[model samples]
Target: MEPGARAVPATLHTLRKNIDSIPQGVQSVVEQFSVPRQQIISDLNNVSHSIGFTIHSLLKEQVYSVLEAIQGRAQDLQNSLHHLQILHKTVRTLTHFQDELGLALRDRKESTVSLLDSPHCTSCARALGKAQSLEPGADYSRVPSVEQVLKTLSGLPKANFPDLIDQGNSTFNSMPDLAVAKMAQVVQDLKDEVNKVSKKVQSIADSFPVSDYTQPLNDALMQAENKSRPYLQEVKHYEKYRWIVGIVLCSVVLLVVACNLLGLSLGACGLAMREDPSDYESRGEAGAKFLLVGVGFSFLFSWLLILLVFATFLVGGNVQTLVCKNWANQEIYKFIDTPGNLPPSTNLTQLLNLKRTLNLTSAYQECKKGAGLWDVLQLRDAYDLEDHLHLSQYTRDFQKRLDNFNLHFEEIHFLDGAGRRDLETFRQSGIDQLDYPMFQAEMQNPVVRTSLEDLARDLEGLRKIQRNITIAGRLANESQALWKIQNATVLTQEALVVKLNESVQFLSAMAPHLQLLLKQTMAEIALIETMLPVQAQRLLRHEIGCFTRKELGYFSQYLNWVRRTLTEDVASCQPLATALDNGRVILCDRIAEPWLYCLRGDLSLPHPPRYSSQAIGRGLRHLQDSDSR
Candidate 1:
């Protein structure tokens, strides 16, 4: 261990300590080399002898070891460099993050200060200043102080840092609550004012003169109340009137029942008298007269009872008529005259116009004389007269009469050979000229024209039929006369046959005695026929031959019978014509009777009876008895 050698050992010792300080796995490899220095030199000599290695190998080994050491040192330095690079990158990222956070904080602080100091913010601050200026004693608690409001608003941004905008909205929401509280306070104040007003009103009401209105109000209320009870009582009175009418009806019925009973008893007595006529005679003239008188009385009484009923009916009818007339004059007529309080001239004009326009001759005539004004006005009011005034009752009645007269005239014209022409004239003149305006205005209305036109057509048809009947009657009379002549001819033929039979029997009885005479008469007839000149004889023979042929021969016998039958027929036919003439006269009389009666208004036929004064008197007496009963 001289100086150099000692340095080597000291280097080796430091090397060994360095190798030992290496990681465990690397220390193990180093420990293997640390066995013995002598063994290490020997093994190196053996390797050198066995391979015959030179100094170059030694130098190569040394160079390889040095390269390995250098490579290891390079790897350790690279690892340390990588760790330092990672550390530098982490420090740079942390510095950059710190700078970004500081910039954001500074920007937020600057924005807060700038926004709070803006002009809009100043306006809000001024509002707060005004609130703060409020008097301390004048409900300042209700009106927020301006300084306190600004402080509260300003604190919002700091207190709710993360939700400053949201807190601003919250402050706005709080204003609604404040408004509600203000409204409530105002409402309470209004209620207090209303209460004060009510008290003042009550005091004024107490000061008013109550006595002045009290008596009049009480009187008015009492009058209204009193009228209510009377109105109810009037209704009750109307109901009582119905009962009173019923009682009167019952009394009348009772009287009628008594009258009927008396009549029946009287009728029974009359029947007994008639059955005992012989007994009445045996009882002497007095009894017979008494029975007769009783029978007469019964008849008179029955007639009287019937008359009484008739009189009662007449009285009732008259009473109903009067009542209807009164009602018409009051309710109907008065209303028509003053319809909705219209002018009287308007009503009168309407009435006259309706009468004229409806073609009601009777009503029109009455209107002309101002007599039908009431009736026409009544109808005008009842119906929508100005709009639909056709065929009111009076007008309808007049039209009915005019229609009947027209029908009768039409029948007469047709019977007199003017049917088609008259019908054409009526259609063209009368029907066509009818007030069609009334129909056009109300075409859909069923009652407007359909019924009237149908009735007119039907009446015209009836007139045509009546005319046809008249022609049929004349034809029927001619036919009947012809039939009678034919019948008479047949009867006369029968009589002629009987007479011819009688003549034949008489001739046959004389046949035996008159045979030679008959032959001589025949020879004479033949010579007389030849004795005349040719033309003369021929003429004579012709005349005789016709006479004999017609009168005697078998053919002549037929001729004679026909001639006799014709003679008898002519004679009978003559009488039939007379009878037919008489029948025609009688038929004419029958037809004319009704027509004449109708014309004269003489209702005295079987259809209309005439009562004697005695009968009338009896009837009156019976009515008196019935009424008394």
Candidate 2:
């Protein structure tokens, strides 16, 4: 009977019509496929080009039909559910309004009764009595009658009396509890109708088997899995390939070693023959020819061994290229491009061409740009490279840059307890707050000044040593030339020996200067250490001075270790050179091994000596004296 209830059936009818329309649209789409497959076959026969077009059209139509059917069904279900929900909400609102109306009526009635029983009403009645008692001229008869008084007391206007009564009666008749109970009955009826419609919808939905649709999704997933599995296996295979390449590289290295050893033995034999060719002549001419043949065979075998080693490297390069290509094709390359494996790009080429047009020294400038003060500091540990060659140049450049930036070394602050303790007690620290004035004074000190002067002098010495090494290299080449001439009987053995001795003399002269430079460097280090605090020193101990007691101890130990290592290295080099001087060729080679190997193997090894713990402890004890004072 309510307006909201009246709209529910019409809404339900519309929803049902929409639901039914979905199946009708689907049936129309399905009926369209009635054009036989034979038609497609006949079209292909008439024009082969039309076959693709026909198949595409047919497949598209089927896919669109399925999509439309699913969409329509989903929309219908949504509409039906929404309609039902709205109906339920409307009923609930009406029930709530009815309850509010009943409460308002009860409240109004109770207020009226309370007002009539109040003292204010009694006072008003007393005033009416006083008006009635007035003299005849006062017109006491003008007072309202009891019926009018009762009407006023009722708090309702005369014209509204009937309407109020009707309203109260209607409200009583439509009690919220009763309305709610009636609404519940109507809701049950509506639910029964909805259930019937739901059954019909369910029956329609059941007509389409889910398995038919799920099968296609499963098939797609299976195909994707099949495609990815081979890539995964390739990754595993590439890992094995890497190991194989490593093994091959190791074998090549061994072969190179073997070849070098063989070559050295053959060269030694050649040298012996040249030294005593007359001794060989004392034997029969046939024996001399046999010796020559043996020497030739040795040279041939050495050449073949070298060629084999070279081939191994070429093969290794090829394998590396293949592996790199395979890596690029893998899924991993989608995330990261391996270094040296990038594809060529026109944009990159264009950029490079533009740089060239600008006259840019691209590679050199890039390297210079990357080189910083830290890089120079790192070079100090690189013994394999001639670090001293660039040391002063890099230092001056860095200092100039720092000056341009208006930057100077600030005092180092330690954040730990040990640092605070060391500072408070005047203990020797690693990177203590720099006393700028003291540093300036020390730099001006004759000893310190002389050390720096000597450093410059030492650098010149190093340059001289470098020049000698260059001369030695040239002489070695000349010696080789002279040896070959002697082998050809163009030069005598004595002349060859004289040239070799000259080269050796150059190397020998260069050695002492290098040793002197090393000694001067050690002396400078000592001066720096002496300038530092007596007890656990800073400065020269670590490249970066120790700031805390713990850091100081670490630096001290590191410096000591470096000092000992350098001493041992220099000491070891002595015997190596001596053995070379003694003509023990094997010993000379052995001596070169330690120096070369150490340089190559531990390229980044810290060269600075470390401070010992005992030194730090002693420093701490000395600082305690200061605290006591």
List model 1 lDDT by residue over 1-629, tens digit each: 02222233233333333323223322232233223323323332333122212222322333333333323322322332343233234323333433443343344334333432344332223222222221211111121112322222221211222232233234323432432343343334333433343333233223322223223433543554455455546656666785785466445444444444444455445435644654322333333233344344444444544564466456544544443443323343344444565665656434334433432334334434434222432333433322221213212332232223210000000011232222222222211122323322322222111122232233233334333454334333433432343244323333433443343333233324333433343343344324422433233334333422322232223223323332232111122123223333332333333334343464221111133447545644544454344
Residue 531 error, candidate 1, Å: 99
Score candidate 2 by TM-score against the native: 0.17
The residue-level lDDT of candidate 1 at 217 comes to: 31
Q: What is the C-alpha local distance difference test score of each model? A: 0.33, 0.32
How many residue pairs collide in each prediction? 4, 15
Candidate 2, 220-288: lDDT as tens digits: 445544564555466567768758864664454444444444544544454456435543223323333
Off by over 4 Å in 1: 1-160, 163-169, 190-629
Give me the displacement of residue 57 in model 1, in angstroms: 97
Please give the distance, in angstroms, between residue 150's alpha carbon in candidate 2 and its true position after superposition.
17
Which run of 10 residues does model 2 get worst, by summed lDDT?
406-415
